[model samples]
Target: MARPIWSGILSFGLVSVPVSLYAATEDHTVHFRQIQRGTSDRVRNLRVNERTGKEVAFGDIVKGFETAEGEYVVVEPEELDQISPGRSKTIEISGFVDLDQVEPIFFDKTYYLGPKGKEYAKVYTLLQKALEQSNRAGIALFSMRGKEYLTAVRADRGILTAHTMHFADEVRDPHREIGNLPESGTTVSDRELTMAEQLIDMLAVDWNPDDYKDTFEEKVHELIAAKQAGQEFEAPSAAPRPSNVIDLMDVLSRSLESAGRPAGADADAGGGSEAGAEDEGAGKPRKRASAGRKKAPAEDLSELTKAELYRRASELDIPHRSTMTRDELQAALEQAAVPARHLRAAS
Candidate 1:
């Protein structure tokens, strides 16, 4: 069992509930120790003085700030402690805001907050339910391990989850970093959009995290098993290199076809079915749907008709449908011209 990282009282307005904070997750990735290459001997990292070329004791080590070139001002640990906020043992909530307004980028690490004792359990649960009903998250600040952290606390199921947040200044402006961006003046035809909508419908499915797996980790375990069994195992096949999509319309149309949707189904929707074409080769981009033209009328592809698909595609601004089979139509819809937006990439 994991240990509680923090013991404190959760101050919700006038209510004070004793609670403990525990890490909500763990990463099981493998790590390697540095060693001598040929001898396979372990290597130890040692602190040394640059000018004297002598090993430094832990007691002699002090934190320093470099104010100028080749110069550093050393500060004692006690001096740092004097400046740091002392332990007060209370997570003070300042205000509550609509949870939707909290940007995902600002979230850092999540922790489980549980009542410290039975006396406080009722109030703890009450706070969680209240937050859920209000659709709001509590903004709070707490000092932990001598450092101050801004946190967001929200109700998840029957439990309260607190997530550390990044300061406003830490987030970078994407527009400044990405440089020049394209305008939305590019035109797309109705027919091409229709095919794309149909393709999306065919690929649509409910989002269930259980369906995904870390293939790389699985492969590593399989290789280890084979080696332990004294059996020879071939290396996994390399994935195909990404092919540059030259024609957006053709790509969207082909993508629709690949999704197993009828090429011309609901042309208005864009090109494919409800579940848009998700090519593992072509990364899943949030812009392809949310920031694109618009969603097809049907929430699910199973509910959509061929005519509706075509209409949705037109709304979505995907193009290039004439003189193409169902397969070609799907591909073309996937390649439709669209603006770039920030999205997470699964490795």
Candidate 2:
């Protein structure tokens, strides 16, 4: 079991439930130490006074707030603690509101909030059930680490969970902050809109976190292993380019066809297939396009991005496609195209 990061009382309307908070996530990203270039010597950062050029001890440092008049007010950590809203112990729930009413942008870090002891289990379960049935979250204010946080507590998988929230002022207005946002009057043809929607429908997938991994993290591990063995690693493929505005419809049509839907499907008929559903039955290879149909020219394969090449390989049902590099995928796709080309020439 993990140690609780916080232990506090959760109070609402004279009822108090003691709870322990645990971190809900972990950082698996690769981290590195600072080292001097071309040497094994370590590089380190030290806190020093700019005026005296002397290293400062940790205990001697104090927080400073710069004022508009060019003076700084030095404060101690104990003073900040004394002025905290809840004094780092109590979380007072003000009220409950519909969970969906809170925008996603307002949510921040999450914590697994569990009852402190078996004695408090009944009250904790009661609140969890109430929040679960009502589909609402309890809004609360709490102090921790010398700072006050607005948080939302709710039922998650039969237990209590809490998410620290951003205050309204902290969230910026995108309309004011951003410059390149599309105009409200930007328009596309009805046919293009329908085809785009159709393409989206064909590629829609179920939300399963287990189905994906951090590929870049895996690549980093691979890189470390290669460097340790003094071996060369292949460079990453170039990113796919943006589609041409003039060929938007054509791009949509091609995307749908690549995902196993026919290009000529009726636009008004909500044209899509259960292709995405087929992918969920994992480990089995995808069904290929009709073999009798002539394929695109082989030389054109070089122009396509790795993603496009991978899609072509999937359509051809090439073996070991997942493990293939970008160049290997293109080669597999070109090899698959040869039989179709031969049939056309033999005829």
- The candidate scoring highest on lDDT is 2
Error of 2 at 318 (Å): 27
Question: Residues 77-174, candidate 1, lDDT per residue (tens digit)?
Answer: 66654664433478889899999998999999999999988988789889999999998999988877656788999999789999999999989998
Q: Model 1 shows how many backbone clashes?
A: 78
Spell out the clash pairs found in candidate 2: none
TM-score of each: 0.68, 0.76
lDDT of 2 by residue, 1-347 (tens): 99999989998898889999999999999999899999999898999998899999999999999996658999988788778646488888999999988999999999999999999999999999999999999999888887889999999999999899999999999999999999999988776776776556445545779989999999999999999999998779999999999888778778867755543443542432323213321433235445543354657777876566656665555655545666787787787778877877899
Worst 10 residues of 1 by lDDT: 338-347
User: What TM-score quantifies how close candidate 1 is to the native fold?
Assistant: 0.68
lDDT values of the candidates?
0.69, 0.79
- Model 2 misplaced regions, further than 4 Å: 68-70, 85-87, 266-347
